[model samples]
Structure formats: structure tokens, C-alpha cells
Target: MTADDHALALALADAAGAAIRPFFRGAWSEERKADRSFVTEADRAAEAAMRALIEAHRPADGIIGEEYGTRNEGAGRQWVLDPIDGTTSFIAGRAIFGTLIALVQDGWPVLGVIDQPIAQERWVGRIGEGTTFNGRPAATRPLKDLSDAVLGTTTPHQFAGDDVDAFMGVARAVAESKIIYGGDCYNYGLVASGHIDCVIEAGLKLHDFAALVPVVEGAGGMMSDWMGNPLDAGSDGRVIALGDPARLDDILDAMS
Candidate 1:
């Protein structure tokens, strides 16, 4: 993809962002998913509009979305999207939610877009082309020793006894960490662009993560699970990411 294609995606994200903003000020109807999570009308609208744009631009491209599920089954090129990652927060009028889009070629991510419309921020990354924030080059912050870094995770109440024990087990070892709830997927985008240092959390899916890997890597970060592997173990969504590979072992040790 050239600068022009990136520009087009930016425009698409901007439009989708605009569509989500009105729901921001006023209340929108919502429904509960089977998982008991809230899904607002904005999610449906944003993904629909995003899907139309991708179809018109890349007719042959595959699409996997949170609200609408998967379409255009092929192995060559694919687009992953989460129109409104934090619908619960968006419905509650929180600013942490955002839109995510990723284009994957062959088996790897080639381009990613994370547009937080409310915050007026666009984080973009194209493999080999480097990563940028609103057209400016972006990089992760200088990695600090594990003993002096900040880690962000979501709600802890969702964990059970053993889960809570395991989570706190890691927390106790961290030099300093905070469980910042309600970020939805925006935290990953923030980490990709170096706004956050590391994030370890549970409960995620491919759509929750696919758009994040390349952007974070493009910004010089590494993400994995408790086993020091990608979250492809086919179990739960326990995942971890760090801005420094040097501290990966430490993070893993704490998780263990």
C-alpha cells in the first residue's frame, strides 16, 4: 500500500469515527450478546459502513468483524475490524473506546489503523513501511527495567480464585503496575504508539488482537501470553505485551 492507500483508510476511519460520535452525546439502543457484553447500535452502524468501504475498495479482500462475523473466505488477503471495541464504555459515554482495522496479506499483517475518534487520534502502521501517528513517525518509549516500569490491565473482578491468585501472583512481582479498567482495545493501540508501556489481560479474541500485533511490533513492542507465546493456544484470552523484549522473561516469570 502506498501513501495514497493509507490516506484512503484514514478517510474511512475518519468517517466511521464521525458516525460513532453522535451516539457519544446521546443515548443509543443496546443489546446484550450471548457473552453478556453490551453491543450498541453504533457498533453495528460503524462496521456496516466500514465493510461497505472495504468491499468497494478491495472487492476480493476477506473481512472478519466483531459484530458481523467473517466473510469472503480466502487465504491471501484479509481485513480485521472491530468497529466499536468498547461498546460498554461507549454506551456509558467513556472516551477509552475506539475503532480498529487491520489488513493482513498472506499470513502477516501489512497495515493497521486504530482511530480513536473521540480523542482525535489515528495510529497507523504498515509492515516494513514503519508506523506513524497521524502521519508522524512513532516509536515505543525507551524500555525500562521490569522493576521500574508501569503495566496496565483491565478489571480484576472478572477473575476467579485461582485466576485471581495467578493474576496477583504476577502483580506482586511487578515493580509497579495498575489495573486500568475500561480501555477496551484502545489500550493496545496506545501501547503500539508508545503511549503505554505494557499490558497483560485476559478475555480477548482474534478480532480483539489481530489488528494489534503488527502495530505494536512496528512500534518496537512484543506481545504474547503467559507461555511466552502468541495468544493462539486455543484456550482463553490471557495475553501479555511489553515494550522491551529484554523484560519479556521477567514478565513471563511473574505470570508463572
Candidate 2:
């Protein structure tokens, strides 16, 4: 994508942020989907706004959103969106929730944004370009050792079956005092901005993580599936994020 396309992506994220801001800290209807996860009117409205923007500017590009289903399925270039990545946190009146937007071309992520509408902070990243936090360059801190790493996850409860054991086993290797819980997509932004060292979680869909790849990686962190494979359209739901790329083998081994 060119500079103009990148700017368009960011603008779409801004629109999504605007669509969700009014619903935050305000009463709104919520419902449970077939998977028993919560969804809100804000989620739907935010996605709708994003979709509208994308359709208007890039009519041929496809879209895969959390609230709305996929469209233009065969289009090689597609946008993956999660209007409210941390709905649980959003509902609880926390500022850690975010809207995730990613552009995938030929099944590879080329651009991504994590926007916290309430806090008015946004992280933008793209292939071969470094990440930027609110338009300033963002970079992660180097990891000296696994034991000193600051770890984060939205919640361990979302881990299912062997995932719980996999995630906890990795956590045990890091300093217990440095672990943080319940920060949704905010945790990934923290990784990009040098606040967190790692984030591991399971059961994520494509939209749940596609938007995070560039932001984390462009900031000098490495994001991948638990097997230490680079993330792409086909990755399994389990994910591991490390601020330092050299720690990928250690993290994967710990989880295994």
C-alpha cells in the first residue's frame, strides 16, 4: 500500500473510534452470541462505520469484521476489523479496550492500527515501516531474560482445554510480580510502546489478532502462533507475543 492508502486506513480507524466513543461509560444494549461471548451495540455501530468508510474509499477491497460478516470474499486485498477488541473491559468502564484495524494483502498483514478512542491514543504500523504511537515512533524494550519479562493477557479464563496449561506454564517462567491481567488489545499496544514484555492468549479469531501483527512487529517485537511460526491468515488461535525476537524459542518451548 502507498502512503495514501495507509492514511485512509488510519482515517477508517478514526471513524470507528468516533462510532464507539459515545457508547463508552454510557448504558447500551448487550447480547450473547452463540459462543456465549458478549456483543454490544457499540461493537456493531463501530464496525458499521468502519465498513462504510472502507466501502466508500476502497470499494473493491474486501472486509472481514467482528460484528458484520465477510464481503467480497475472493478479493486479494482485505481489511480485518475488531470494532471493540476488549468488550469486557469496555463494559466494565476500563480504558484498556481498543478498536483493531488491519489490512491484509494476499493473506499477509501489511498495515495495522490499535486505537483507544476514549484515551485518544492510536498506534499505526505497516510492513517494513516502524510502528508509531499517536504519530510518534514507537519501539519495544529489549528483553534481557525470561525471568525479568513483564507479561500480560486479557484473561486466563479465556484459555480453554490445554491452552490454560500452556499459558500458565509460560507464565511460571516469568516474574510473577511483573504479570498483568485484563488489558485486551491495550496490552499489545503496551508491548509496542515498551510497557509490556509479552502477551499470550488462546481462542482468538483472525480479526482478534490480524490487526496486531504489524503494530507489534514493526515496533521490534515478534508475534506468532505458539509453535513459533510467523502469524498469517492460517495461524491457529493460540498466540504468543514477545518484545524481543530472540526469546521466541524460549517462549514456545515454555508453552510446549
Choose the strongest candidate by TM-score. 2
- True-structure RMSD for candidate 2: 1.0
**lDDT on C-alpha atoms for all candidate structures:** 0.75, 0.91
Point out the worst 10-residue segment of candidate 1 by lDDT. Answer: 230-239
Candidate No. with top lDDT:
2
Tens digit per residue, CA lDDT, model 2, 1-256: 8898898888888898888989999989999999889999999999999999899989999999988899999999999999999999989999899999999999888899999999999999998999999999999999888898999998878898888888888789998898999898999999999999999988889899998999999999989988888889988888888899998888877888
Candidate 2, superposed: residue stretches over 4 Å from native: none
Per-prediction TM-score to the true structure, in the order listed: 0.89, 0.97
lDDT of 1 at 186: 79
Worst 10 residues of 2 by lDDT: 247-256
lDDT of 1 by residue, 1-256 (tens): 5676677677679768978988896978889999988888899888898888888887877888889988886647777788987777787778888898877666565677888899888778776766777778778776666656666776776566666776776677666444455586778777776767777777777677666776777788877766787543143567777777778877776666
